[model samples]
Target chain A: MMLRQGALALAALALTAPGMAQDAVRSPDQIVAAAPARDWVTIAPQDLLVMTLAPDAEGNPRKVVIQLIGAPFSQGWVDNIRTLARDHYWDGMAILRVQDNYVAQWGQPDPGMGIAEKPVPEGLKRMSDADYTAGSPNWLTSSTLRATKEPQVIGDWPAPMLTDPYGDYATFREGWPIAGIQQMHIARQWPVHCYGMVGVGRGNPPDTGDGSQLYAVIGHAPRHLDRNLAVVGRVVEGIEHLSSLPRGKGPASYYADPAKRVPILSVRIAADLPESERPHLQYLSTESESFARYADARANRRDPFFVASAGGADICNIPVPIRAVAAE
Target chain B: MMLRQGALALAALALTAPGMAQDAVRSPDQIVAAAPARDWVTIAPQDLLVMTLAPDAEGNPRKVVIQLIGAPFSQGWVDNIRTLARDHYWDGMAILRVQDNYVAQWGQPDPGMGIAEKPVPEGLKRMSDADYTAGSPNWLTSSTLRATKEPQVIGDWPAPMLTDPYGDYATFREGWPIAGIQQMHIARQWPVHCYGMVGVGRGNPPDTGDGSQLYAVIGHAPRHLDRNLAVVGRVVEGIEHLSSLPRGKGPASYYADPAKRVPILSVRIAADLPESERPHLQYLSTESESFARYADARANRRDPFFVASAGGADICNIPVPIRAVAAE
Candidate 1:
């Protein structure tokens, strides 16, 4: 038995050798490397958020790029956030909380800390708890939406898709994992709280969120927050900056000392920035064949180093691939 | 229709109000707080690993407490590691790797860097690849074992259990989750790789691991490594010391600069330390009713703040609870 196991292991290793003729199973890396340019979708400048932070110790400004969820999904919140950036509402605001294995949030220390109170903008309505889900009437218009009652097979294993009894099926759409339920003939969807996904912060009442305060999940997927909180978007680049910050010390891991807070130098919409300063970011379209292959490869990795495939993958496990195009 | 949606949202919130008559689901925090003393298992000093690092910039020594997976599972690796610690083989050895969203590993830069290589100890035999599993003949001796093919119900939802067509069903055993398959009347089980779980790093071919190099999973649960690597234990406390380190720059995130490497002050078995210096640590027993309740609460949280429970939870979502005991 021992000899047989050893021989099997050796045979597996040989399949990965450079000169071997047999083609090994395509790993996620291999699948991604072979993808065509057309399989990638460029981010619309109007949907991009560029947040610049106070200089690091070495005097280099730290920047985080966020890609907002498209129309019919938290569009009101996204528009409000973009307006806030245009008005410089987030300038000088500090990242006040960095709870370990949770989130990093930033906003004014007080609601009116640095800016004067102003009338609520037109079309920027207070999002109620009902608006926090895809089941809402506003999200029923997307034609590409679909619902699944069973786990989707990716690669050779069943993907870790969940059928929530309380809501619509949780699945992926357009490179973003969304949770939604079907009402009548339409499917309503909201973005999930996966790592690096950004959400709007609020007080006791659900409708208080107005895009003034925002947070990004920095650790494990806090999926319970879905349908409860407004997940406005996801960080496309520079998540390491947010995740690597020193953990706060106060309740909910708020920075106890004022000096430790990381400050926001400026916040700008990609379209509003000078062409030279704007980032040319692109993401793997969920509809692309390469994406399907990539998702399957990730769900059941067949890399040489891995002895056994997990045969399953959770929604959070599949991070959408993004890359920055060099400015011409 | 909008009004009805609003009414339903309001009704959901009402269920969580303090005065509601229905028994609110017990949260994981509540279950843990209400646990009886018998539900807690004291750690044997001999099985405790105390790793002390050079003082941080603030002049306080960085200490990490690790709890070894008990007998018959990776015992050979454990014994060899303990012997290495006793010989001070790790003293001055640097933490060479800190891969972002992955692992932090530490040991000598090369074999025999700080200490001379010696003959393998009498009891510390080379563990074969087959020993990396619970289904092996050696692990079949444990009596407190059980196997399940169905998803375990944790709280109101089914736990995210995987049925690996290639190997065994992945589920929990004691507080530790395991991958096991039943043969005839007996079940075979082995420890799983979850966040904060420690593993023995080795070279090509499985038998080469002698426990000299060790790493802790500091990011996503790499379940694909299940039967591939030898996982010896987990970090019970001070994981922030490992997770918060600066990521290395070299391939696989190895520290490229020697000056940036964090140095190990000492590695000692708790039993070898003075009684006053030993950690008074205990973990919630997997066999305890409190543990079951805690697992359920984690899977489908009923906390007042959570608006909707994720009807399922992956293995990495359920962290084994541990606490330090006050000196008698």
Candidate 2:
């Protein structure tokens, strides 16, 4: 229905902030103030990947979860992912590469273990940084790979589609930056990639990323990847792990040693596992009233802890929160 | 004697770059290339923090080392830090806060539980982001903290420090765009706060960060803290452990539930430990001849890997390396 009516109809139903429904960018605080319960949706357990790491020498597991739901993530291979993340699967994994201000990647069981004998040229892992130059207003572009979507004008009319909004300035709907939750009126759609966002780690060499090797955005929101990479989920829990790999020693942070790789015991899709084995999960609905309040607190940060309000917020800077749902 | 005679000698050195030998903006590569052997100091193991996380439920003892040197982290605290790091003395610690685009920090073990807390206020905590923006660049005065230095003569006298070198063509030193390094050299030294940089985490009031709680920068370096905070060290490894923490549900990433604190087993000074216990250590000496070749390679990127060279470098973008050395 949203696709049929187009953006104009949906604009009226769209939210500018969490619960505030006035829908003006200028009045972010007021918009969430009026949102209804119809805005939020409960995330399905099947859509979740609760990542629990085995205890380090201290016997404390660094536990964090990811909610993977987009297209490719849900497409069949998720079961293998569950196995990979479960039971010390990534133990002694190798940190394949770490490109500065770009990514710090960790690969499965071993990367150098099965060498083809020849140093087959590592395929190009392209970054938008290659195309963009400082002081130039032009958008970054590349001929290498189309990882992000481009604006298209179809039949002389600008056409937009609905997508899951994770990063950038996604206004809250049901506690997630959801698309298509409102009255089916808007035709516009774009995906945002902000910090703490997670995308499947893939290799240009083909099928290199089985989702076992993953990464999180730690610096600025490398937003250009929204349409390009299969963003399976967001790091609902721990993201800092991928962000700080001590900047790597070699060209990329390809740690030269076998022992340097951070091990991943396993990754499990919540829905495939038994109830007792599942991770406790809960996320405030972006479309709900409570969530609007949360986004508000994060947007301007009017709390006593803040000495001054930043006044304006870039959608990337705003916080999207998730928590472990406790057993009743 | 060096400080007094250095002025005249620098006048002669200035002839190399912009008319002042001492006034040149030397890149890290250039700085290391030209620096005398005395300018580089071997990091004493006693000053290093051999941080080892206790075995998690799976029993992987994730071992890492952190070093605190220069000011604040001094020889006096050697014994104290040794106990804190090597012996599992300060285990099961708490993460103090997760500052956006900046840092994620963890505090020391509880006092009654057996560890002594560092009483200093968190280094470089913020009062407002505006201080970084339009508010008042001059508000730097009146504070007890000293200002960092950047020296360059505009028309034969030093000009104002420009943070952006390539974007702004800031002053040059030994062929590098420089500021704070010089400031610190003149005894007006301030901390260098960039990614993976470490500082103590503190409470409501700034300056409350003691050695007990530690933080590592996961995002853009918060340069605002250069002089305001006592930067203890930089993360040699395992910064992902800090950056990837599920952002605390509350503001500043303070996890609302105490149970969520990612535990820290201990933080120690590396130098105090026995040599046999050290991770075979080495670093791409910034001052080494090989680094000069590497920096040029980076500056021009003539390698087959890069089709086009960036032709420029950012201070924060430069990679400072640390390595595990194997004895010949």
Winner by TM-score: 1
Across all models, the iRMS values in order are: 8.1, 15.8
Q: What would the per-residue lDDT of candidate 2 be over residues A135-184, giving only the tens digit for each residue?
A: 21122122111111111111211111121112111232223332111212
> Candidate 1: where is the Cα deviation over 4 Å?
A1-23, A110-123, A136-170, A179-188, B1-25, B110-124, B136-170, B181-187
Q: Which stretches of candidate 2 lie over 4 Å from their true place?
A: A1-40, A50-64, A69-111, A115-196, A204-213, A216-230, A237-268, A275-280, A285-296, A308-317, A326-328, B1-194, B205-214, B218-328
Cα lDDT tens digits for candidate 1, B201-233? 887677878888899987666666777788889
DockQ of each: 0.22, 0.07
Q: What is the lDDT of residue B314 in candidate 2?
A: 33
User: Which tens-of-lDDT digit does each residue in A111-151 have in candidate 1?
Assistant: 53344445544556577777776554443322112212123
